[model samples]
Target: MLDRIANIIVELKAVTKEAKSLARKEILYKDELKKIKLENVALRGQNATIIKERDQAIKERDQAFNNLPLKDNPDNRKVKELLFANKIVCQQRDQALQELSIKREELLKSLQEAKIAKKDRDISLSNLDEVISKLEAYQNICQEVKSKISQGKRVDADLLIEYAERLLFEEELGSTSERKLDYLENSYMFTDQASINRSLLDR
Candidate 1:
């Protein structure tokens, strides 16, 4: 009977360990999802700005084309020269606008894919059950600690140690996540062909 009881206790410990591991994974996933959402919002803002620039480019190109005289009157050399110059400028603007359109399409596709991935992740998180209990337990522990601290009782060494570990883990995780996000954003900047074209046009 004692051997059987010992085996049950061991099994329980294993289960508890697995639960803790799952809880940690859940927390990490939540943080990652938050980061992804923030990036998506930023991407949307960029897309809006790109669209505005593209519209402006189109408008300028149209204005130049409209200003060009249909018939270059050779007798009026100055007028012919002005019209020819405007035509070249209009062509250049049109080419830049076409390139911007292609880049915008690619960005839209990427944004759509990201949205799908986020939706799938959200569904997965919603189906998860065990993490809620673990989170609640953590919150309860925090509340208890606060209550004890308020009542003038010194926090036990073990409790303080656990809190310290949590703080260290959070600090490390935050630092690493920010570094990773920064690198990813920087990498994307290099691939932003539309932004480069806009810069060139502005110059």
Candidate 2:
């Protein structure tokens, strides 16, 4: 009867210990559940804030897209006007270039004409020089002939005839040629008019 009482006491202690352990586990489970619930509540609040921000961003993007001009809008007309103005400027530039080209051509033509006129003037000056030389040569011949006649020297008939012919044919003597011909016929030692005439005709 005493051993039975001891075993009963031991069994009571074991039951008490197990009950305390289960109570402690229950309290821990409740604390963990409370923390999870708090975390879930916080996550719900963060999700709501994220959704509100996403909706606001979408609204702003839509409003910005709506402000852009459509394909056939009046803003496109402004672009067309600008293009037309640019075309007009380009046309004016082309016209100015054409005028410049025409002016350049005119200047070149004027320059060529000036060159031609200068060349013609030079040729005329050269011809004038030749005429002056001929005049001087005729004057010298006349002086020589006059000197020979005044001094009563024997004039070379052949030389005088040749010089006269040269003045008449090979060169231009203007009025001097006529005077010298007359002087030779009247004052020279040609014995007769026929001899002087023959010498003149021989040329």
Candidate 3:
């Protein structure tokens, strides 16, 4: 009977010890569960922050889409503006080239007209030279005639008739007026035509 009681007492002691160990394990498990709950709360806060940021981004994107035209883009508009400007530049350049061509044509025409005018001037100068030559020859013959008359040589009948005819012609021309005297005084100098400008010098 004592041996049976001893075995019963041993078994009861083992059961009590096992109960205490199980109690300690239960406490540890509860602590671990509390930590997990705290971690879950932190994760929930992070998730909320991420969701808030995503919502704000979506709102801004929707606002931008509603404000802008469907087909409008900044880069596309800039390229079109550049193309328009380039077309304007091309037009201006072409207009300038056309104006330059017209100016060149006008310049060429002016050059041709100037060449023609130069030719006319050269012809006029040549005619004036021939007239000067004839006047010089006439002056030399008159000088010879005057010198012979000064030496008391009588002029021929033909010469006398010519002189008479010239005097009669001068009377008909009205140069016998006082204006002839003024003309002789002002223009009978050596600068008249040739070196023998002595016709009106003896006024």
Question: Backbone collision count in every prediction?
Answer: 0, 0, 0
Collision pairs in model 2? none
Cα TM-score of candidate 3? 0.39
In the range 69-96, model 2's lDDT, one tens digit per residue, is 7853456665576556556655655565
Cα misplacement distance, residue 53 of candidate 3 (Å): 51
Quantify all predictions' global Cα lDDT against the true fold: 0.53, 0.58, 0.50
- TM-scores, in order shown? 0.36, 0.45, 0.39
Q: Lowest summed lDDT over 10 consecutive residues: which window, candidate 3?
A: 188-197
**Segments in model 3 whose C-alpha atoms lie over 4 Å from true places:** 1-79, 156-203
Best TM-score among the predictions, by candidate number: 2
**Model 1 alpha-carbon miss at residue 67, Å:** 2.1
- Off by more than 4 A, model 2: 1-76, 152-165, 171-203
Query: Which candidate model has the greater TM-score, 2 or 3?
Result: 2
Task: Tell me which residue pairs clash in candidate 3.
Answer: none
